[model samples]
Target: MTHLTLSDYDISAERGFLCRYDAPDVELHGKMAAVRNVAMALPKTLVTGRLRDLMLRDLPNNVEADDIADLTDEQARMAMVHYSFLIQAYVWGEADAPALLPRALAVPMHALAERLGQQPLLPYSGYVLDNWGLFDADRPIDLDNIFMIQPFLGGQDEAWFVLVHVAIEARAGKVLAAIPTILNAIATGDTDTVRVELEGMATHWAAINALFDRMPERCDPHTYFTRVRPYIHGWKDNPALPGGLIYEGVEAFGGKPQAFRGQTGSQSSIVPTMDALMQVGHADDPLKAYLDQLHIYRPPGHRKFIDDVRTQSSLRHFVEGAGDRDLTLAYNAIIQAVADFRSRHLQYAASYIQKQGKTSAGNDPDVGTGGTPFMKYLKKHRDETKARLIDA
Candidate 1:
């Protein structure tokens, strides 16, 4: 458990699962410099219906896999964040969704994706984890000081949507950092320590919920659905792409279509890590299956951290048998916290996506960005979490 600290996974105890490095170097060299410029212009070009045109005109071809691989891990992540937005915008930014992704985007993105062990599209890491920067270097990563580094249509709505998630990730750091201690306490039958840790986790969960409550402050639901949501949808199960996207000049696909899930909050490791800590389980279903598939979309170290937590945690079993009223109460608080968070998420899914009017080919109001009918499953999972509470 000692070896499972957040830093090992490129996650910061202070930043939770947010990027651990400084803002990416602004002055990229040669062809990549152009790529960076194109990526930066997306917020404007996408609205002007000229993103694809700009990419086609300026994006370089055959950015060697070796060159993409040569960048340090943080730089690679920054590149992936930019390339992912470019690829998504290229496909969905225009009116008619393009079936073929030019080698300019597909080739280097594939190589970067391979190097990072992530899907070659926008992922949770790119969306929230690595795609942020501080307004003030001396300040902590909070709603006031944090801003999105990369965005599809950057504005208050989009910025608020991302910053809220960033705030929650940073807020969860205390709880995440206490995992080893909680596990150790549970293993040692130190009910007092376990109780305190669980209570602390519950407190952090409350703060996280408060952060979640701010989603609607500046991010209008309709704007999120029509503008922000469209570019993030994946090719799989999406009618726009039908058979998926063809990645040109990438040897792995052999000129065939590749289907990868788009960026979704489900890919965020926060809830999954919490579930693992609480030993909560969702029955096998499409959403569950989809989630398991998304495990590969997370950074490799994060996947390991979640796996290790699930394997190492026996807190529920320990709490059930302890027969300590206070301990059971503390544990149940966390369960309720998880359910509460899910309940809010379910509400937002309906308002921010499900209930919104459909405006384009790829952005289906009924389907999540990750390509699932999420309403039913989200409710079901929330109910199941409530069922996990140990009754007195």
Candidate 2:
């Protein structure tokens, strides 16, 4: 019964699930400017105690949930981005992470995270979705025109890694736009319309995979494992922080440790959305459980979109029964695309994280940033998707 319109979920044909926020606006001035100033310099200030020093001196104080509640949606999102980056740097920037987050950082970050309905740390929405801007407003959000607005180390590798994800999110708009059309076409038994839309969806997916293929162009595997991967890790399931992280002054936490998943590509709603549309179900397993846990990490609207697509779509069932060669072929093409993307992602997981040597306690090479034995499940999901293809 849920409407499938993009705007209903704050999504769009131009940006897909990516946040519509652009950086460097007049709104980020005044009180919030201090947060951005500190975040912009986080990479350069990552000496043993330098980040902590900069944060205590430079970060604004007395930020409460009420203050976040007063701002417009854009300002709130910007605040989340700045505060999330600063919190991650404070926790992971040094050689050893501190068990306790100071009251100054903990209080504001907790309030912002509460207001945004996410955990009090970096999230995919803040990390990649909202953490980007255009080099030139007139150009598209392609790799050439886009750059990461916030980064842990601000290197070519880091920027390239994040920017590639952004580019894929932009390209996904077309595929998302086709969802309702395909579903409605299925309902009307309009096989031709369904076939055309499925073909288009598969084409857009190919472009997304092309973007994924460029991951190593600038983000070296070793650099990604050491520099880029370490800071984004959350405390849960991490051997380094067995007790999890403590937010010293976030009264809601009662001085106990908090555990949340790190920002990983799995949190992106694109694959989930596609899975929902195709009705590709994963057997309940550790990876499925981890993915279910990550559902809350996404923006609430995205969660709704995925759920609606799953419940409402009859594409797979229709294709299986249509007995139309072209329609079944179109549906099979999309299934194959999803399978291929997962396979490439599995390869990257092995090369980018699994094969790389361990450099820090927090970043376990065997575990994914989201805290799963990813290699085993990535293969499972890929095979499951491929098996869903309609048989001739």
Candidate 3:
């Protein structure tokens, strides 16, 4: 069987998705400048009005199969990158009222992905796989190495929050690389190899937790809640967007509707990797279920990579060993912190989702408005891991 590399999917560009970050001549650049001017000079209502109009009028709404054929290779690539940032800003810039993304932006984005043979959204796996070499544990975290562009119109608070996830995703990439070795050890009953791999896994979790700890220093709570948090809102229940974001020409798998519930894009990435590491495989494990459903959001190769990791057994044996106390504690702390992170996101959702006249209640078995099941699983996993350490 052939394995996939990031280059196979045309995602190996050094700049990640921000290909237009330096492109000042693109039509999208002019529109972005206009939006920023309005944001700085106008009232909140006026800013939103201007942005909505710009989105509907300025951006390319109707994308067909032959659209990219008309452009040079570089032009097509820049168009995709430019539109990626535009979609993020249009959907997430407004705090209380995120505009429903029209076909102009949405269709072209989907078409761009199809043209490139990639997924519509920048899946977390792509970030990890494409940038695998940059994720050295010994190196200092560099904000510039992040996969997504710094929101051109967003503030420092927004930039910091995005960097934090970029750092965490780097750490996740390291963990993902080691998983096959750990699983190989488990399959062969190599306890010593398993112990070593588990230790490394714990270290990766610590690094992720450290990034979370640094969030306050980079972005204060006030700025985060007010500026950055609102951008991550999903379309679960807002009256304005009844069916959430609809990708034209994208059909739901298994005959379900092709609407996306509101979510922070990277939120689905790290926690699921940790959950797989600890083997928290309860029947109601929300992370596991969510990950299973989330494959559709990823490219085919990325989906295969995630599935390979999930199918492995949990590393519970290492916790039962006599010298694994620190590893156990580190593992428990990581799970707890992830659960806390999810809880905080829920609080943010509560404040914004319902205020827009959208139902915060989610009916998806994989995910809901409140992440109650995932939280419960994390708590149970943490307690059980601690108990095993004590008993050992």
Q: Each candidate's root-mean-square deviation in Å?
A: 1.3, 1.4, 7.3
What is the TM-score ranking, best to worst?
A: 1, 2, 3
lDDT of each: 0.87, 0.87, 0.48
lDDT of 2 by residue, 323-342 (tens): 99998889899999999999
- Ordered list by lDDT, greatest first: 1, 2, 3
Considering only N, C-alpha and C atoms within 3 Å, which residue pairs clash in candidate 1? none
User: Using alpha carbons, what is the TM-score of model 2?
Assistant: 0.97
The most accurate candidate by lDDT is 1
Cα deviation at 324, candidate 1, in Å, is 1.0
Give the range where candidate 2 is weakest over 10 consecutive residues by summed lDDT: 21-30
Error of 2 at 148 (Å): 0.9
The alpha-carbon lDDT assigned to residue 241 of candidate 2 equals 76
Worst 10 residues of 3 by lDDT: 12-21
Q: Over 4 Å off in model 2, which ranges? A: none
The predicted structure with the larger TM-score, 1 or 3, is: 1
Tens digit per residue, CA lDDT, model 3, 1-392: 13324333322223222121223233333433343333333223324545666555544444554665565544454555455545545665443344345556666667666665555543333222222223333554455544333243455766676666656655555555556676776666666676676567667666666666666566665555544444333454434345555554444322222444333443344455555666654454654465455556554544455555566555665555435565555545545555555554444334333223322223222333322234445445445433433332
Off by over 4 Å in 1: 1-3, 24-27
